[model samples]
Target chain A: MKVRVTVMLKEGVLDPQGKAIGHALHTLGFPGVEAVRVGKIIDLDLKSTDAQAARAEAEKMASELLANLVIEDFTVEVLG
Target chain B: MKVRVTVMLKEGVLDPQGKAIGHALHTLGFPGVEAVRVGKIIDLDLKSTDAQAARAEAEKMASELLANLVIEDFTVEVLG
Candidate 1:
Protein backbone atom coordinates (compact mmCIF):
# COMPACT_ATOMS: atom_id res chain seq x y z
CA MET A 1 0.00 0.00 0.00
CA LYS A 2 1.02 3.59 -0.62
CA VAL A 3 0.20 6.45 1.70
CA ARG A 4 0.84 10.15 1.70
CA VAL A 5 0.97 12.25 4.83
CA THR A 6 0.85 15.98 4.41
CA VAL A 7 2.26 17.94 7.32
CA MET A 8 1.65 21.63 7.40
CA LEU A 9 2.17 24.42 9.86
CA LYS A 10 -1.10 25.41 11.45
CA GLU A 11 -2.49 28.85 10.75
CA GLY A 12 -0.98 31.63 12.88
CA VAL A 13 2.27 29.66 13.13
CA LEU A 14 5.34 31.57 12.00
CA ASP A 15 7.09 29.93 9.05
CA PRO A 16 10.41 31.53 8.33
CA GLN A 17 11.21 29.10 5.56
CA GLY A 18 7.98 29.81 3.75
CA LYS A 19 8.62 33.50 4.05
CA ALA A 20 12.04 33.05 2.54
CA ILE A 21 10.58 31.14 -0.37
CA GLY A 22 7.91 33.76 -0.90
CA HIS A 23 10.59 36.44 -1.00
CA ALA A 24 12.51 34.43 -3.51
CA LEU A 25 9.46 34.14 -5.72
CA HIS A 26 8.91 37.88 -5.60
CA THR A 27 12.53 38.50 -6.47
CA LEU A 28 12.09 36.18 -9.45
CA GLY A 29 9.34 38.44 -10.79
CA PHE A 30 6.35 36.31 -10.01
CA PRO A 31 3.91 39.16 -9.71
CA GLY A 32 0.60 38.69 -7.93
CA VAL A 33 2.00 35.85 -5.88
CA GLU A 34 0.25 36.60 -2.64
CA ALA A 35 1.41 33.92 -0.21
CA VAL A 36 3.48 30.80 -0.26
CA ARG A 37 3.09 28.25 2.48
CA VAL A 38 5.56 25.39 2.28
CA GLY A 39 4.83 22.04 3.81
CA LYS A 40 6.01 18.45 3.74
CA ILE A 41 4.67 15.51 1.76
CA ILE A 42 5.77 12.21 3.19
CA ASP A 43 5.20 9.29 0.83
CA LEU A 44 5.24 5.93 2.56
CA ASP A 45 5.20 2.43 1.18
CA LEU A 46 3.75 -0.03 3.61
CA LYS A 47 3.47 -3.79 3.44
CA SER A 48 -0.17 -3.94 4.45
CA THR A 49 -2.82 -4.29 1.77
CA ASP A 50 -5.89 -3.16 3.66
CA ALA A 51 -6.64 0.52 3.02
CA GLN A 52 -8.35 1.17 6.33
CA ALA A 53 -5.66 -0.61 8.29
CA ALA A 54 -2.92 1.19 6.39
CA ARG A 55 -4.58 4.56 6.89
CA ALA A 56 -4.91 3.96 10.61
CA GLU A 57 -1.29 2.92 10.91
CA ALA A 58 -0.10 5.85 8.82
CA GLU A 59 -2.15 8.24 10.93
CA LYS A 60 -0.42 6.88 13.98
CA MET A 61 2.90 7.32 12.28
CA ALA A 62 2.07 10.92 11.50
CA SER A 63 1.03 11.74 15.04
CA GLU A 64 3.90 9.92 16.65
CA LEU A 65 6.91 11.04 14.64
CA LEU A 66 5.95 12.75 11.38
CA ALA A 67 4.31 15.86 12.78
CA ASN A 68 4.84 18.38 15.53
CA LEU A 69 1.32 18.38 16.88
CA VAL A 70 1.84 21.53 18.87
CA ILE A 71 2.36 23.71 15.79
CA GLU A 72 1.69 21.48 12.81
CA ASP A 73 -1.29 19.57 11.40
CA PHE A 74 -1.22 16.41 9.32
CA THR A 75 -3.60 14.60 6.96
CA VAL A 76 -3.22 11.04 5.80
CA GLU A 77 -4.20 9.70 2.36
CA VAL A 78 -4.06 6.05 1.47
CA LEU A 79 -3.36 5.37 -2.21
CA GLY A 80 -3.23 2.07 -3.94
CA MET B 1 -6.69 31.10 -7.72
CA LYS B 2 -4.82 28.52 -5.72
CA VAL B 3 -2.00 26.37 -6.98
CA ARG B 4 0.03 23.65 -5.36
CA VAL B 5 3.47 22.64 -6.53
CA THR B 6 4.76 19.31 -5.42
CA VAL B 7 8.52 19.01 -5.55
CA MET B 8 10.21 15.67 -5.10
CA LEU B 9 13.73 14.36 -5.21
CA LYS B 10 14.55 12.62 -8.46
CA GLU B 11 14.94 8.87 -8.34
CA GLY B 12 18.50 7.76 -7.48
CA VAL B 13 19.07 11.03 -5.71
CA LEU B 14 20.33 10.55 -2.19
CA ASP B 15 17.90 11.89 0.40
CA PRO B 16 19.51 11.91 3.81
CA GLN B 17 16.64 13.85 5.29
CA GLY B 18 14.16 11.20 4.23
CA LYS B 19 16.41 8.45 5.53
CA ALA B 20 16.61 10.13 8.88
CA ILE B 21 12.82 10.44 8.97
CA GLY B 22 12.41 6.77 8.11
CA HIS B 23 14.82 5.81 10.84
CA ALA B 24 12.95 7.95 13.28
CA LEU B 25 9.70 6.25 12.38
CA HIS B 26 11.30 2.85 12.83
CA THR B 27 12.54 3.78 16.24
CA LEU B 28 9.08 5.03 17.10
CA GLY B 29 7.70 1.52 16.45
CA PHE B 30 6.24 1.69 12.92
CA PRO B 31 7.23 -1.80 11.88
CA GLY B 32 5.39 -2.03 8.55
CA VAL B 33 6.91 1.17 7.24
CA GLU B 34 9.00 0.10 4.28
CA ALA B 35 10.25 3.39 2.93
CA VAL B 36 9.67 7.08 3.40
CA ARG B 37 10.38 9.80 0.84
CA VAL B 38 9.90 13.38 1.91
CA GLY B 39 9.09 16.22 -0.45
CA LYS B 40 7.79 19.77 -0.46
CA ILE B 41 4.30 21.07 -1.09
CA ILE B 42 4.22 24.73 -1.97
CA ASP B 43 0.80 26.35 -1.74
CA LEU B 44 0.38 29.51 -3.72
CA ASP B 45 -2.40 32.03 -3.84
CA LEU B 46 -2.39 33.99 -7.06
CA LYS B 47 -4.62 36.78 -8.27
CA SER B 48 -5.35 35.30 -11.65
CA THR B 49 -8.66 33.54 -12.30
CA ASP B 50 -7.68 31.42 -15.30
CA ALA B 51 -6.92 27.96 -14.04
CA GLN B 52 -4.82 27.06 -17.06
CA ALA B 53 -2.76 30.24 -16.90
CA ALA B 54 -2.33 29.88 -13.17
CA ARG B 55 -1.14 26.33 -13.60
CA ALA B 56 1.33 27.36 -16.27
CA GLU B 57 2.67 30.20 -14.16
CA ALA B 58 2.93 27.95 -11.13
CA GLU B 59 4.78 25.38 -13.22
CA LYS B 60 7.22 28.03 -14.27
CA MET B 61 7.61 29.11 -10.66
CA ALA B 62 8.30 25.55 -9.65
CA SER B 63 10.89 24.97 -12.33
CA GLU B 64 12.71 28.26 -11.96
CA LEU B 65 12.55 28.99 -8.25
CA LEU B 66 10.80 26.30 -6.25
CA ALA B 67 12.56 23.16 -7.43
CA ASN B 68 16.16 22.29 -8.16
CA LEU B 69 15.78 20.97 -11.68
CA VAL B 70 19.00 19.01 -11.53
CA ILE B 71 17.84 16.84 -8.64
CA GLU B 72 14.16 17.59 -8.17
CA ASP B 73 10.99 17.22 -10.22
CA PHE B 74 7.81 19.22 -9.70
CA THR B 75 4.14 18.95 -10.55
CA VAL B 76 1.66 21.78 -10.51
CA GLU B 77 -1.95 21.41 -9.49
CA VAL B 78 -4.46 24.22 -9.78
CA LEU B 79 -7.22 24.25 -7.20
CA GLY B 80 -10.44 26.19 -7.38
Candidate 2:
Protein backbone atom coordinates (compact mmCIF):
# COMPACT_ATOMS: atom_id res chain seq x y z
CA MET A 1 0.00 0.00 0.00
CA LYS A 2 0.96 3.62 -0.47
CA VAL A 3 -0.15 6.74 1.32
CA ARG A 4 0.26 10.45 0.80
CA VAL A 5 0.12 12.88 3.67
CA THR A 6 -0.32 16.58 3.09
CA VAL A 7 0.52 18.93 5.95
CA MET A 8 -0.34 22.59 5.81
CA LEU A 9 -0.01 25.52 8.15
CA LYS A 10 -3.31 26.60 9.59
CA GLU A 11 -5.01 29.69 8.33
CA GLY A 12 -3.70 32.94 9.90
CA VAL A 13 -0.22 31.50 10.31
CA LEU A 14 2.53 33.59 8.78
CA ASP A 15 4.72 31.73 6.31
CA PRO A 16 8.00 33.51 5.80
CA GLN A 17 9.31 31.17 3.14
CA GLY A 18 6.12 31.42 1.13
CA LYS A 19 6.17 35.18 1.43
CA ALA A 20 9.74 35.21 0.18
CA ILE A 21 8.77 33.17 -2.83
CA GLY A 22 5.88 35.51 -3.56
CA HIS A 23 8.21 38.47 -3.39
CA ALA A 24 10.57 36.77 -5.81
CA LEU A 25 7.72 36.11 -8.20
CA HIS A 26 6.66 39.74 -8.04
CA THR A 27 10.22 40.86 -8.71
CA LEU A 28 10.35 38.50 -11.71
CA GLY A 29 7.40 40.37 -13.27
CA PHE A 30 4.73 37.85 -12.33
CA PRO A 31 2.12 40.50 -11.85
CA GLY A 32 -0.57 40.25 -9.19
CA VAL A 33 0.87 37.40 -7.21
CA GLU A 34 -0.59 38.54 -3.93
CA ALA A 35 0.23 35.70 -1.57
CA VAL A 36 1.76 32.28 -1.30
CA ARG A 37 1.33 29.57 1.32
CA VAL A 38 3.65 26.60 1.48
CA GLY A 39 2.83 23.09 2.55
CA LYS A 40 4.39 19.65 2.55
CA ILE A 41 3.50 16.32 1.03
CA ILE A 42 4.84 13.06 2.31
CA ASP A 43 4.70 9.96 0.12
CA LEU A 44 4.85 6.71 1.94
CA ASP A 45 5.46 3.16 0.79
CA LEU A 46 4.01 0.63 3.16
CA LYS A 47 3.58 -3.12 3.22
CA SER A 48 0.19 -3.39 4.81
CA THR A 49 -2.24 -6.08 3.76
CA ASP A 50 -5.37 -4.26 4.92
CA ALA A 51 -6.24 -0.89 3.50
CA GLN A 52 -8.36 0.14 6.47
CA ALA A 53 -5.67 -0.79 8.91
CA ALA A 54 -3.08 1.02 6.86
CA ARG A 55 -5.14 4.18 6.78
CA ALA A 56 -5.65 4.07 10.51
CA GLU A 57 -1.97 3.62 11.08
CA ALA A 58 -1.09 6.38 8.67
CA GLU A 59 -3.42 8.78 10.47
CA LYS A 60 -1.67 7.95 13.67
CA MET A 61 1.62 8.61 11.99
CA ALA A 62 0.39 12.02 10.87
CA SER A 63 -0.68 13.03 14.32
CA GLU A 64 2.37 11.67 16.06
CA LEU A 65 5.22 12.42 13.70
CA LEU A 66 4.35 13.79 10.28
CA ALA A 67 2.60 16.96 11.42
CA ASN A 68 2.79 19.47 14.21
CA LEU A 69 -0.74 19.80 15.52
CA VAL A 70 -0.03 23.15 17.16
CA ILE A 71 0.30 25.11 13.96
CA GLU A 72 -0.57 22.68 11.18
CA ASP A 73 -3.20 20.27 9.92
CA PHE A 74 -2.84 17.19 7.78
CA THR A 75 -4.78 14.92 5.45
CA VAL A 76 -3.93 11.40 4.36
CA GLU A 77 -4.72 9.81 1.00
CA VAL A 78 -4.31 6.11 0.37
CA LEU A 79 -3.23 4.73 -2.98
CA GLY A 80 -3.03 1.12 -3.94
CA MET B 1 -7.01 33.54 -10.17
CA LYS B 2 -5.19 31.02 -8.05
CA VAL B 3 -2.34 28.64 -8.76
CA ARG B 4 -0.92 25.68 -6.90
CA VAL B 5 2.66 24.61 -7.44
CA THR B 6 3.95 21.27 -6.28
CA VAL B 7 7.71 20.80 -6.01
CA MET B 8 9.42 17.51 -5.37
CA LEU B 9 12.96 16.27 -5.03
CA LYS B 10 13.99 14.23 -8.02
CA GLU B 11 14.23 10.50 -7.69
CA GLY B 12 17.64 9.27 -6.39
CA VAL B 13 18.06 12.47 -4.39
CA LEU B 14 18.66 11.99 -0.72
CA ASP B 15 16.01 13.45 1.61
CA PRO B 16 17.18 13.58 5.18
CA GLN B 17 13.97 15.17 6.47
CA GLY B 18 11.88 12.44 4.92
CA LYS B 19 14.19 9.77 6.35
CA ALA B 20 13.85 11.34 9.76
CA ILE B 21 10.09 11.29 9.51
CA GLY B 22 10.20 7.65 8.44
CA HIS B 23 12.31 6.81 11.45
CA ALA B 24 9.84 8.58 13.70
CA LEU B 25 6.97 6.63 12.17
CA HIS B 26 8.80 3.39 12.73
CA THR B 27 9.44 4.28 16.33
CA LEU B 28 5.75 5.02 16.74
CA GLY B 29 4.92 1.47 15.66
CA PHE B 30 3.78 2.17 12.11
CA PRO B 31 4.70 -1.21 10.73
CA GLY B 32 5.62 -1.71 7.09
CA VAL B 33 6.37 1.94 6.39
CA GLU B 34 9.29 1.26 4.09
CA ALA B 35 10.07 4.71 2.75
CA VAL B 36 9.03 8.35 2.85
CA ARG B 37 9.60 11.18 0.42
CA VAL B 38 8.82 14.81 1.12
CA GLY B 39 7.62 17.44 -1.32
CA LYS B 40 6.27 20.98 -1.23
CA ILE B 41 3.08 22.65 -2.37
CA ILE B 42 2.80 26.37 -2.85
CA ASP B 43 -0.62 27.97 -3.11
CA LEU B 44 -0.75 31.27 -4.89
CA ASP B 45 -3.29 34.05 -5.03
CA LEU B 46 -3.02 36.00 -8.25
CA LYS B 47 -4.96 38.85 -9.80
CA SER B 48 -4.77 37.84 -13.43
CA THR B 49 -7.60 38.32 -15.85
CA ASP B 50 -6.25 35.64 -18.16
CA ALA B 51 -5.80 32.10 -16.89
CA GLN B 52 -3.40 31.11 -19.64
CA ALA B 53 -1.07 33.98 -18.90
CA ALA B 54 -1.30 33.31 -15.20
CA ARG B 55 -0.26 29.71 -15.72
CA ALA B 56 2.66 30.65 -17.89
CA GLU B 57 3.85 33.23 -15.41
CA ALA B 58 3.47 30.77 -12.54
CA GLU B 59 5.58 28.23 -14.37
CA LYS B 60 8.34 30.74 -14.70
CA MET B 61 8.05 31.56 -11.02
CA ALA B 62 8.39 27.88 -10.21
CA SER B 63 11.49 27.59 -12.32
CA GLU B 64 13.15 30.70 -11.02
CA LEU B 65 12.18 30.68 -7.34
CA LEU B 66 9.86 28.00 -6.04
CA ALA B 67 11.94 25.02 -7.20
CA ASN B 68 15.53 24.15 -7.83
CA LEU B 69 15.62 22.56 -11.27
CA VAL B 70 18.97 20.96 -10.54
CA ILE B 71 17.53 18.56 -7.98
CA GLU B 72 13.78 19.20 -8.09
CA ASP B 73 10.77 19.15 -10.42
CA PHE B 74 7.56 21.13 -10.19
CA THR B 75 4.00 21.17 -11.54
CA VAL B 76 1.46 23.96 -11.47
CA GLU B 77 -2.33 23.74 -11.14
CA VAL B 78 -4.57 26.73 -11.75
CA LEU B 79 -7.81 27.39 -9.91
CA GLY B 80 -10.37 30.04 -10.63
Give the winner by TM-score: 1
- Give me the runs in candidate 2 sitting further than 4 Å from their true place: none
Going through the candidates in order, what is chain B's TM-score? 0.96, 0.94
Candidate 2 local lDDT, A1-80, one digit each (tens) = 88888999999988998899788777877768999999999999888878887788789889988889999999998987
Candidate of highest lDDT: 1
> What TM-score does candidate 2 reach?
0.91
Q: What are the runs in model 1 whose C-alpha is more than 4 Å off?
A: none
DockQ each: 0.90, 0.85
The TM-score values for the models, in the order shown, are 0.96, 0.91
Clashing pairs in 1: none
Docking class of 1: high
What lDDT score goes with residue B30 in model 2?
Answer: 76
Evaluate all candidate structures by whole-model CA lDDT and list the values in order. 0.91, 0.88
lDDT of 1 at B9: 99
